[model samples]
Target: MTSPATSDSAFTNNSCDTEKIHILDLFAGPGGLDVAAHFLGLESTGIEWDANACETRYSAGLQTIHADVRTMRTERFDELPDNINVLAGGPPCQTFSVAGNGAGRRALTEVKSFIKRLVAREESSETIDEELSALGDPRTALVLEPLRWVMAAIENGKPYKAIILEQVPAVLPVWNVYREVLESGDLPGGVKYRTECRVLHTEEYGVPQTRRRAVLIARLAEHGHASMPDKTHKAFTRPKAETAPTGMATLDEAILKEAEHVERPRANRKEREPWVSMSEALRESSKKLGRSEPYVVVSNYGSGGDPKNRGRRTSDQPAFTVTGKISRNVVETPDGQPLPRFTIPESGILQTFPSNFPWRGRDQAQQVGNAVPPRFGAHLLAAALGLEEGRVAEAIEKMDGWPQISEEERERLRKIGCGDKGKCPTKPPHPQG
Candidate 1:
């Protein structure tokens, strides 16, 4: 029998996790994080606010809860698994993204504190204290929500021993706030003031897309340790290229060499529409093309009534941040002319979703808007884990030689030959008959 999308993927069966870890993915969409975590052998419970996202996760055998993290605490839960060692989530980052006018940065004050308190409560639980939780709290890094939550969780003792938060580069100021907060010792947890923050571009880290995010990593064991997962992939170069070399990765290189781009059969597919090419975007905006183009423009004036026309889009530039809101996906028509809405898959690919992956939301916009780029998130998490980021097949090529022993077999041998083996040595006595 053929396996479902949930059932079989060679890459998933052998992700970098290589061990077991527990994860709580808050605001996790379609369980992309869950899928990656599961690949790393981490058990996950995905909590997503969107019903469509919940269904997508459900197809993967995840215990996907459809509820907003912002409202989850107010609502009571019947039962839940024990203390989570790892807590993870990407908060809905609408009001605080860099793409918008530098407004809504205030989302931190409005909602971040509640999330902090939630983390505090979860950490205090006897159930949770027993295990490690890798949680990405606050979703957005606005006002250092993740750091603040970590501070709360530790509460003078160590709660989250390891924490990693991802955000847009524009949020560096907030990270500075994290430094200030932890240093001030104004919150809970034993976290010290000094932490580590770095810029991690997904493209540089083996993800096929051109996404750069600010990553914060902290090692609580030290007097003060805040660190992030380091980069693994490098830029694609000329001459003879090396695989897994600490170099740059190119869009064409990663996509063609690594990502399995979908090629829908022309006969069965809808007639494809050709849009302005990259070169077209590089040209100057047309003076004649005002907001009058309805199908092509996303302006409020003239015919540009569509909400997608709020901003200028060009092929040469990376797209604006892809938010949970689909209304942001519109673009002005080429030639400054009016045009139809961006195709769901088109907008989705712009956000870095693999072409072959399918989305499940009711509308094309909903599906494209709700999803996190699996390839990007996968690469980021892999980098965070301090392991290589590549598909199983790609990874295989990098290894000097394949191990003769299977992982399961090696694990069994390890149990018998390593852990507690010395305490109680066992052997078959010499049988001399």
Candidate 2:
């Protein structure tokens, strides 16, 4: 399929300045940031590496360049709209995820050293490449790709007005280093920006999962102060006491009183609605299919290759963070009798993908797993654009619904599996996206 037309502006400029605000999303897996930009009535283009994710982006009518961000820089930048004001990306985080093999943690010190060397202009071209090659795992340095692009754009006199990046919380310190470099105007070309780095819990922003992301937002050339987004939903707090089983139930009487007497903690009281749970989001969908009460779901609790890390999620709580293996999540009855695994549509719902959004191509679960929840993304974009509170709330609500899917698409995704040896109940050679 052909790419979306580049001639058309992604968004119009309503401000006194004539330049429009288009977003260029680097490392744009499945176009999550683009989806959020669209919700705000903005235009965006994404550069993604994986073919399956690119295919999903294409099928959904999103503008995308199906190539690696590292290699696509020159050609893709040349095609960017004149007013590409915002740059956003969520670089692949497996190398930096806390739940993974300690590669990210172990490499953190070296990654920070690299960032310092990069900023200090201490390494020659040969040494830079040699050192990156010598790292224990080079993927840890993928987080620096955005910084490279930012410097390049600035040097070209086309610095993005706003920059946004998100990753697993383990990447926070790296973002902090980026914040220092961007704010200090330390680059050879001397571009200065204001940046804020923070850890954001997705549930606080109304995503129906407890995912935490390390986020950095920047305004180029100190155009304005950069602020992290405010939460739109109530934060889920556990009792001070260690309640058995769920670890969130009852606390000592004094502790409960202390909790009530203390400040509400969250900023916005008017909009502090309760957290939406997996049961609440999926209940109606399940009932529509005549599934009975007492739904049960079993899936991995953490991201790792080990089976021991897998666990279950009751209907009452929001699901553990959805991962690339999400399709393997089993839906069962009360007695542990397995029903169907979560259909692709249901998994999308959990991840806040619009209902019926085309999830075609290979590695559907990975594509879905890696995506930023559109609602959460919309909230962050709204904050970036300084959209009014009313408008932010409105956009989020609109994104919360399921996209309508046709039976043909549903049938196509039925029995979706990884298709690895012995992994599929069906036959070998599972359909590739």
Among these predictions, the greatest TM-score belongs to 2
Q: In candidate 2, which residue pairs get closer than 3 Å at backbone N, Cα or C atoms, i.e. clash? A: 355-402, 355-403, 361-433, 362-433
Q: Tens-digit lDDT track for model 2 on 1-433?
A: 2122234422222111213667888877876787777767788888766667766776666776655666556444565556676788986677666445445556766777777787776666346545654565556557777887887787777777678888887777778888888888787577777777777778887777777777888765435556666666777663232122222122223223322322225455476678878777767667766666576777654223335544556677677677887777777887888787776767777877776677879888888889988878887776565566777677666665534545554434321211121322222111110
**In model 1, where do residues sit more than 4 Å from their true spots?**
1-18, 74-78, 98-102, 106-158, 180-194, 206-210, 222-226, 229-358, 363-367, 388-433
Candidate 2 accuracy as lDDT: 0.66
